[model samples]
Target: MLQIKDLQARVEDKEILKGINLEIKPGEVHAIMGPNGSGKSTLASVLAGHPGFEVTGGQVLFEGQDLLDLKPEERAREGLFLAFQYPVEIPGVSNMTFLKTALEEIRAHNGLPAFSAKEFMKLLREKQDLVEFNTSLVNRSVNEGFSGGEKKRNEILQLAMLNPKLAILDETDSGLDIDALRIVAGGVNKLRSSENAFLVITHYQRLLDYIVPDVVHILSGGKIIKSGPKELALELEEKGYDWLREVETTE
Candidate 1:
């Protein structure tokens, strides 16, 4: 559903991603694990068309369209969703209002009509049940006063509601307790389908146990050094990144 070729991205004058190449098929989940400052999160940011990052080279194709050509909102309109590791709080925007606006925009882009408040709430409740998202937060400002778990769950709640074709979750496991992690994983698993794909960026192998990956890629020094099944994650967790790097250097 998504393919990136020789992806190179920079923040300001400092380049972060160097020649990243990955392809994700629908119904597949790919976990990207890397040491700190290895450009893992940069890849996610670049894919989502974040304005702060510049594409120095390469192309990203979302179902055949050049993703770099689209604006961030346009990327979202084209069925790309990126759940940020750090969700920003919009003090003036109510959670329900923010979601409704996004839903309407996406619906329009997809040639669907806007939802009435009742219809929107009905859809929201259904999605909430799917993700087990709490209803109390819906009326509050987006991300305002949300606990770490709540922020992550709200992100997944949006995912469940939008039903994007491809979802890029950058560091979804960060700051989450075991219970929260399971809840987040459950929400993501519920959304998995033949027409959707997931790019899960994480540091620990524990998250992999909850959301099994079709492929595990070890990214280090800005490139993928090892690619294998879920067993690769276990190997890394057991042996540490130092061993993985040593093995990569030998290869």
Candidate 2:
């Protein structure tokens, strides 16, 4: 559902993503693993149309549309979801209110009717249960005073409610206890289906133990240097990223 070809991007004068080529089809989960400053998150940010980064070269197509041409909100309305590495807090906006407005806007963009009050509540309940989100937090401000785990789960909750065709999870497992990690992963697993795809960016192999990506890619020097099956993550866990330097040199 998404295709990226020789995608290059830069922040100010320094280039980050250099010729990143990837394609994610529906029903597939792709994991990108890299060390610090490898531009893994930059790819996610670029895909989500972050204004800070400028697209210098190549193309990105989302469901055959030129993704780069759309504004960030337009991209979201088009079924592209980016779960931030650090989910920001909106002090005055309640979580429920934020999600309701987002969902309604997306639906309206696609010419769908807004959910009735009862219907909205029912849908909210289902998604909250799916993500194992704290119902009590629903009435609280978005990510305001939330723990790291709570913030991540809230991201998953938003993902569930939006039901985007392509979800880009940028370091969702960055901070969590094992139990919280399992809950978050479980929610993601349950949400997987033939109609949607996921691009997961993480640093550890442990995250892959639960999400079980269909493909694992090694990104370095702002380029995808290696891609293999899920077992690649295990190899990376054991061999470390240093060995990939040889791979990059050869390429």
Candidate 3:
């Protein structure tokens, strides 16, 4: 569903992603684990077309289209979703309104008709139940006054609503308690299907315990130094990233 080739990106002239090459197919879940400043989040932002980060080289194709050529909103309309590590609060914009507008725009882009008020409410309720999202926060401003878990759940709620082809979750486990983590992961598992793929970026292996990935990649210094099965996460958890230095040195 997504193809990234030698992707390099920089923020304000300081390069973050050197050359990230990853291919995610439908029905597969890929986890990217790396230490701090390893360009994990930078890869996500670059894929989402964040204006703050400029692509220095390489190409990204989303389902055969030139993903890098599209704007951020265009990327979203094209079924690419990025859940931020830190979900910013948008004051004065109710979560319901924000979601409705976004969903309408995406559906229109896909040549689908907009949902009627009654249909939208039904979908909202169903997705809320699917993700166990807090209904009380629906009427409030997006992420405003929400706890960390609430914000993460809000992100999953958006994921459930949009039903994107490829969802890039940038550290969704950050700041989440065990219960919240389970809830968020459960929502993701439920949303999984043969038509969609997930790129899960995380630091700890605990999140992988809940959302089992088809492949686990060790990213260091903006490059993927190793790729293995799910057991790689267990080994990384036991041995830590230091052992990978030898692997990189050998390379």
The clash tally of candidate 1 reads 0
Per-residue lDDT of 1-251 in model 2, one digit per residue for the tens?
Answer: 99999999999999999899999999999999999899999999999999999999999999999999999999999999999999999999999999999999999999999999899999999999987887899999999999999999999999999999999999999988999999999999999999999999999999999999999999999999999999999999999989888888888
Residue 164's lDDT in candidate 3: 97
- Runs in model 3 deviating more than 4 A are none
Give the higher-lDDT candidate: 1 or 2: 2
Clashing pairs in 1: none
Candidates in descending lDDT order:
2, 3, 1
lDDT of 1 by residue, 1-251 (tens): 78889888889999788888889998999999988998888888888887899889988899999999999999999999999999999998999989999999999999998988899989899988865678889989999999999999999999988889999999999999999999999889989999999999999999999999999998987788889999999999999888976877798
Which candidate number has the best lDDT? 2
All candidates: CA RMSD (Å): 1.0, 0.7, 0.7
Task: List clashing residue pairs in candidate 2.
Answer: none
Candidate 1 stretches greater than 4 Å from native? none
Alpha carbon deviation, residue 102, candidate 1 (Å): 0.1
Worst 10 residues of 3 by lDDT: 129-138
Scored by lDDT, model 1 comes in at 0.91
Better of 1 and 2 by TM-score: 2
lDDT of 1 at 221: 78
